[model samples]
Target: MRVPANRRTPLHEIAHARAGDKGDTSTLSVFPYRDEHYPDLVRELTAGAVRRHLGDRVRGEVVRHELPNLCALLFVCRQSLDGGVTTSLALDAHGKGLSSILLSLEIEVGEIEVSPSSPPR
Candidate 1:
């Protein structure tokens, strides 16, 4: 079994994210800044973890989709929007800020690991 790393860091430090919304569902895709960190993310960035991190913002479900070839994880959040973009009065009705919010979640990471100065495309 793998033990948690000593240091805790926000996901944004290790990865970048993009967000989209359709109706009341929000989708956020996260890609590691370095390929080597993919495994750690895969192990720690779970649906429950995201759901818990998102808290009351997500009302229905959070599903995690693994994209190993791209070293990415996509989270599909349901009932996250107050209504759709057309109906919600939220400041972020489009849910574009959801990516930033998800990136704010902190997770255990290796002490030896250093975030890249710039993320790769």
Candidate 2:
């Protein structure tokens, strides 16, 4: 799914997501928007605020992608002991603020498993 470069849709607002197997690792690709604001949202969410919220639940490398007018953040989080990946998204005031411009935000979650033969043959 390709978002244009004008509309501003929150990541949680993503309607559809897909998780697929990729050579022993799960791959999740989300189309948070159909317009431009995707990159901004990706940037803001992957920053300190969101990272802090994730805490120890997240591990491994975090990769970010930016285009002329597109952006995305990818993280290889640790699978929970329950064998599921847990995730969450929250929006609140930055500092000494009263109200937030973000009335509310949304989040989408997808999961995939890696294939066994992905590694060395």
TM-score of 1: 0.87
Q: In model 1, where is the ten-residue run with the lowest total lDDT?
A: 112-121
List the global CA lDDT of all models: 0.87, 0.34
Instruction: List, residue by residue over 1-121, the lDDT tens digit for candidate 1.
Output: 2334667888887789999999999999999987877887898899999999889999999999999999999999999999989999999998898899989998877643543574344
RMSD versus native structure for model 2: 15.2
Candidate 2's displacement at residue 49, Å, is: 4.8
Per-residue lDDT, model 2, residue 27, is: 32
Q: What TM-score does each of the candidates earn?
A: 0.87, 0.35
lDDT of 1 at 20: 91
RMSD to the hidden true structure, all candidates: 4.0, 15.2
Q: Best candidate per lDDT, number?
A: 1
> Which candidate number maximizes TM-score?
1
